[model samples]
Target: MRTAVVFPGLMVCVALLAGCTATAPSRVRVDQAEGGLPNCKTFAWIPTPQQPATLTEQRVKTEVLAKLKEKGYSEAEKADCRVTYVLDVHERPKNKPSVGVGAGGGSGGIGGGIGVSLPIGKRNEQAGTFTIDIVDAAKNAQVWSGSLDATFAKAELNEDEAREIVAKVLERYPDRAPN
Candidate 1:
């Protein structure tokens, strides 16, 4: 029937679209202290040891600040909570197998041969982990932490992309300041 043919074509189109729009794989994890998040609404950035000094760091910082503001938190010199972020990037080991095809013919006869493929080289892809931590200023201990691990084809990220990553991680945070 016409409906059956069209349905299969539409399904194929949908599958192709999905493949085209695939996003990088990412995982998010959150940890909280025994007492849970403090009811503090203000935050200050504490220096992270060996933090990467790069343009990407600046972009991430900007996005984090924006997200915090959106969550009704403000920055202050003497805030009740302190915050910090770390970005780490490294190359992932390649584990993909190669693919191949073979065809052959002989004069006055038919012949066939089998071939196996072995990968010669691989493209190096980098994976990055972004982590944000909140600490209670009075107690000087961590209150809550969120971490995102993502595989990337490139190292640089624009503002919107950076915002997307930060937003995904911060989505786990309370909708409003914790009480």
Candidate 2:
């Protein structure tokens, strides 16, 4: 009847909606130096010894550079400021019941209960943490830092996702003063 048709249609709609839904980034942690953010218009990227030059790193750097430029900052080899970033990924297991039970009964003097348990495909979760730091060239110390953590169902971060994350993290950056 109408119930049968409506139920399946509703389920389909729900599935489509879930697939199209976008997850929001988690809480961000921001720290400013004791003297507050330094005043600088040019920046250079200084990679850590442990972090090699990789495609992901390059993409993140590009996105961050674009954002900084949009904020009226320029990149320079001997600039007043330096920028560095880090990206980390971790895997976690999803929480789920290990066992399940089912019961059944019939009116014709028949009743029975069944319990079944089986190993389902492992459902692992992944999370990524991104951090950006800015240092004052004259002070030789970090002036500001921002970090964001988000969970994902996949192991790798796509370019779009990485750009979005970088944008979200940089949203906390302080605005530059008028020249």
Candidate 3:
């Protein structure tokens, strides 16, 4: 009984103390960079609140670089073509989506307080922000750049998940290059 009662507190504790980072698409929709190439691609990423611009950032960068290299955009610009990508990461605060429940049979006299909500529905109020960014690596300026948001689950990231998500987001990159 006591453990059950402590569940809510624990949930709240995790929600408030533990950092929840969800990765979404990109942010920058427009590009201001000058110069154009048909085959060059550049990239830079900004870290999220949970993960700052550090070693973890390098991991993310390396992933992007690998993908770009694989796509054959690493030397796109050198060939006097068009290709460039500017990326960044950022985060914001969000209310935990949650649900609620309450058992009342007879009368009541100010049951709970404001913050103390008795969930009557599913827990859909787990508040947490996301870590995402915008990737622009199109022809002239921005041929591809979008935002991304994700939730935090693993302290150490799994490469498979990272690649899949990044690939999914890039799938929607603007088509300035030859189709």
Winning model by TM-score: 2
Model 3 residue runs over 4 Å out of place are 1-53, 75-143, 154-161, 174-179
Name the top lDDT candidate.
2
Provide the lowest-lDDT 10-residue window in model 1: 1-10
* Model 3 poorest ten-residue lDDT run: 123-132
Report the C-alpha displacement of residue 173, candidate 1, in angstroms: 0.8
Better of 2 and 3 by lDDT: 2
Greater-TM-score candidate between 2 and 3? 2
Candidate 3: tens digits of C-alpha lDDT, residues 1-179:
11222346645645653344344554423322354223334444432357455444455556655665566455333332332223333333334444443322224332332234343543331222222333243332343334444443343335664565556555454333533
lDDT of 3: 0.41
Which regions of candidate 2 fall more than 4 Å away from where they truly are? Answer: 1-25, 48-52, 95-119, 153-155
Candidate 1 C-alpha lDDT tens digits along 1-179: 11211245545655675576556666789999988788878888886568666777788888888898899898898998888887687887544543333333445443333455565677777778888888999999998999999766667766776888889989898856455
Tens digits of per-residue lDDT, candidate 2, 93-168, equal: 6654333322333443323333445547877788778899999999899999999988755656667877898898
Clashes of each: 0, 0, 54
By TM-score, rank the candidates, best first. Answer: 2, 1, 3
Q: RMSDs, each prediction?
A: 8.7, 8.5, 12.3
Better structure of 1 and 3 per TM-score: 1
List lDDT for all candidates, in order.
0.76, 0.76, 0.41
